[model samples]
Target: MSDVWTWPARIGVLLGAGLFLALLVPILVIQIRRYGTTSPARLLGAAALAVYGTALVAYTLLPLPSGDLAAWCAEYGYPTVQLRPGQIFADIRERTAGLPLGAVVRDISVLQGVFNVVLFVPWGILVRRYLGWGLLASAASALGASLLIEVVQATGVFGLIPCSYRLADVDDLVTNTVGGVLGALIAPWVLRWMPRAKTLAATRGEPRPVTVWRRWLGMAVDAVAYTTLSGLLAMAWGLVGYLGTGQVPPDTVPLWLFASVLSWVVVFVLPLATGTGESLGQRTVWLAVVPDVSRVADGGVGLSWSARLRRGLAGGALWGLLQVLSDAATMFDVGALASASNLASWFAAVLVVAVPFTAGKRGLSGRAAPYRLADAREGAGALSTHR
Candidate 1:
C-alpha cells in the first residue's frame, strides 16, 4: 500500500534513497558476473529492486508527524522551562490518548494487528538480527531508546525534561515492550514477504565490534571539535568588534571572557549525561566524586530521572552561584577605581570557582559533561593499560 507522504517522510526517503540507488550498481555487477544478464534473471532482478525501492520509498512517505507533534506540545507549554516529577506522568497520560489501538483490535480484526505490529517492526529486526539479544533484551533496549528520544525532546528541545520526562513510565514501558515483541514477531515474515528482496538490517555497533571506551573516546573527539568551533567564533567576534568600534569596547572584552567560560558548558560538557546529569566526564575523570561504577555494569549511563534532577540541581546550582560570584567580583571596583578589597574579592571568587571541580569525588568539574574527556587521554591512559 502507498504511504501518505509527510515532511519527515520526505527526509527519511532522501536518507535511504542514496543507499537504495547505490544498491542498483551491485545488481548489475551480480548479473554480469553470474549469468549472461538474460531475460528472466534480469526481469527478476529488476523486479526485486523495484520492490525494495518501493518499500523504502513507502516507509519514507509515512505520515509520522514527530516535528508537528513536538511543536504542538511546545505550543501548550507542555515542556515548561521548569518541571516536576508528577508532570511526567501527566504527559504520559496525555500522549497515551491517541496511541494506536492495534493490540485492542487483535481479537476481531487481524488487519489491525498489521498496523499495530508494523509500528515497531524495526525493533524486532534490530534485536534479532543486529543486537542478537533475546526477548527481554530487545524489550529493554526498545524501552531505553524510546525513553531517550522522549528525554532529548524534553531536555534539549523543550527544556522541560522533568523527572517524568526523563523517566520511562511503567505503562509506556510495558506498551513499548509489547510493541517491540510485536515488531520482532512480525519481522521475519516482513523480510520473507518483501517481494524478492534481500535487506540486511544494521545496528549501532556494541558488542565485539566496538568497545565502550572507544565510543566514549569518539564522543570526546566530537567535544574537541565543538570546542574548536567555539574558539574560532570567539576569535572572529573579537576581530569584528575591534575593526567596527575603532577600539575594543570595555564591554566587548568581558563578553569574550564570559563566552569563553560558558562555551565549555555548551559543547564538551553536555554529552556526558548519565540520566541523572552526572556526565561521563564526572563519572570517569571525577570518578572519585560521582562513584558511577554501578552504571558501568548496568551497561549504560543515566537512567533514573530523580538522579538526573538531583545531580543537575546540586551541580548546576553550586556551579552557577559560584560563577555569578566571579562575575560580580570581576566587575566590582573600589572608590578609587582600584581598591585592594575588590582585587582580593575577585581573587577569592576565582579560587572558589575551583571548589566544585574538587568537591566530593571531585565530581565537581562543574564543567558539565566534559570531565572524562579532559582526563581520559591523560589519566585513564595509564589506568586503561592495566585492563
Candidate 2:
C-alpha cells in the first residue's frame, strides 16, 4: 500500500513541476490582461490545480509493468471489470466480518472506497469555485471525468497496454460522483476569499497608476516573452535546415543571432513602429509609453513613427547592447567578453531594481527616453496632454 502511494507521489511532484514551469508565463499574462493586476490567490490556485491534475493521473494509472506484460498479468492475476454497484459495502463487510464498526471503517476495502472519492474532491472544488460552474454542472463534470478515467483503465489506456492494470469498478464511479457533489456544496466556503473573474473583467478597463511593481512585472513579462520567442525561432530554424539539407546546421551561432534579432524585432520594434509605443510585455501588463510633453517639440500629440522609434531606441539601447555582448561572449567562448557581459548584466539588473525607487518611478529606460510609461487604460491622448 505504501509503495502504491510512494511511486504516484514522486510522479506527481515531477510532472507538476514541469507543468508549472510550462504554464507560468501564460498564467501571468492572462492574469495581468484580465485583472489589470496579479492576484496572489489566483496564482496559488493555478499552481494547486496543476498539482492536482498530475496527481490524479498518477494515482489512477501509474506503475505499469516494466517487462513481459503477458507474464506479469498472468503472475499478478489482474482483476476483471467490476460492473456491480454497491460492491464496496459487500467487500468491506466480507473483509471485516465480526469486527467492530471502527474496524470496518478502517478496513482496506472500505478505505479504498473512501480514497477513490477523496481523489476527485479537488476536481469538484476547482470546477465549482475556480471555473464558476453551477453545482449540477460541477457534479456532471465529475461524473464524466470519473467515467473517462474508468474507461481508460478498463481499456488498458485505450489499448496501449495488453491488459488493464487497475480495476474499473462501478462502485468507484458512484463514490467519485458523490464526492464531486459534496465538493460543490462546500466550494463557496472553501474559496470565499477568491476574487470573481467577472469582477476583474468588468474593471479591467479602468485606469490604474503606473507603480514600480507594475513596471517590474511588465519587464518580467517582456523577458519571458523574448526568451520564449527566441527558443521557438531557433527550433524552427534548425528544423528547416534539417529538412532542406538532411542534417541540422552544424554551427548554431548564426541561428542564435538570427533568432535573438528577430525576437527583439517582434517583441519590441514592431510595437514602436506601429505607434503603440509598448513592448509585448508592457501591453500584457496594461502599460504604454507616451511622449513627455515638456521634452517634445511637437506638443506630444500623435507621435510620429520616427519619434516612436527614437523613444524605443533610447529606452532599450544600453540593455540591448549588453544583451548582444552577452550573446557574443556565449557563442564565441571568449573569457574577456564573458567577464564584460557578466558585469554588464549585473549593472543592468541593478539599474532595473534601483531606478524604480526614484521619484519618477521610471527605470533607466524610461529616464533615457523623452517618454513616460502610463497605464494603458489612460488613453494616449490623455497621457500625452500631461507630463
Candidate 3:
C-alpha cells in the first residue's frame, strides 16, 4: 500500500522539478510581459500546477510492464474497460458489507473512488480561479480532461503498449468531473488572496517606480541569458565539429572565442542597433536605458543610435571586458589571468550591489554613461512627453 503511493510521488516530484526548472525563465518573461511584474502567489500556483500535472500522469499511467509484456498482460486478467456507471458504489458496498461506518470509509474500493475525485479538485480550482474561467467552462474542461485520460488508458497508451494495464472505469470519469465542479464552486474562497489575471493586465502598462531590487533582477537575467547563450553556442560548435571530423576538439579556445563574439552581438549589439537602448534581459524585465536630462537646460529628447551605442558601451564596457578576459583565460589555461578575472568579476558584483545605496542609485555603469535605467513603460511615456 505504501509502495502504491510512494512510487508515484517520487516520480512526480522528480519530473515536476525538471519541468519547473525548464519553465522558470519563460515563466518569468511571460509574467513580466503580461503583468509588468512578478507575483509570488502566481509563481507558487504555477509551481503547484506543474507538480499536480506530473502527479496525475504518474498515477494514471505508471507501473508499466517491464519485460515479457504478453506474459504480464495474461497474468493481469482484469477487464480493460468498465462502461457501466455506479459500479464503484456497488463495489464499495460489496467490499464493506456489514462493516462499521469507519471501516467502510476505509475500504479500498471506497478510497479509490475518493482519491480519483480528490485528484482533480486542483484542476477545477486552478482553471476557474487562477485562469478566471467561467464555472461552466471549467467544468466542461475537467470532464473533457477526465475523458481523455480514461480513453488513453482504455487504448493502452494510444496503442504503444500491448494492452491496458489498468481499468478505465466510467465511475472514475464521473467522480473526477464531480470533484472538478465542486472545486470550481469553492475556488473563489480558496484563492481569495490570489490576484486575477484581469486585474494584473489592467495595470500592466502603468509606470512603476525604479528600485534597486528591480535593477538587480534585470542584471541577473542578463547574466543568466548571456551565459546560457554562450554555453549553447559552444556546445553546438563542438557537436558539429565532432560529427564532421569524427573527433572531439581537444582545444576549446576557438569554440569559446566564437561563442563569446556571437553572444556579445546578441546581448549588446542587437539592443543598441534596434534603438531600444535595453539589453534582452532588461527588456524582458520591463526596464530600459534612458538619457539623464538633470543637467540640461532643456530636457533631453530620445536618444539617437550613436548616442545609445555610446551609452551602452560606457555602462557595460568594464564588466563586458572582464567577461571576455575570463573566457580568454579559461580557453588558454592562463592561471594568473584567470585569477585576475575572478577577482575583477567579484569586484564588479560588489559595485552592482553597492551602487544602488549611493546617491542617484547609479551603478558604476550608470555613472559612466549619460543614461540611467528606468522602467520601460514609464520611460517610454517620459520620452514621448519630451518629444
Return the top candidate by TM-score.
Answer: 2
- How far residue 4's Cα lies from its native spot in candidate 1, in Å, is 8.4
Model 3, span 91-149: residue lDDT tens: 98789999999999888898889998898899999999888999999999999999999
Q: Which TM-score value belongs to model 1?
A: 0.28
Residue 30 CA displacement from its true place in model 1, Å: 18
Per lDDT, what order, best first? 3, 2, 1
Candidate 2 local lDDT, 251-370, one digit each (tens): 467865787777777776776677557776678788877767777687755566666656565554335546656666776676777775676567658667765675566676565556
- Which has the better TM-score: candidate 2, or candidate 3? 2
Model 3 clash pairs? none
TM, every model:
0.28, 0.86, 0.79
Per-candidate Cα RMSD to the true structure, in Å, reads: 22.3, 3.1, 4.2
Q: Please report the TM-score between candidate 2 and the true structure.
A: 0.86
- Global lDDT of each candidate: 0.42, 0.77, 0.77
Q: Which of the two candidates, 1 or 2, achieves a greater lDDT against the reference?
A: 2
In candidate 2, list every pair of residues with a backbone clash.
none
lDDT for model 3, on a 0 to 1 scale? 0.77
- lDDT per residue, candidate 1, 285-312, as tens digits? 2221222433344434333444444444
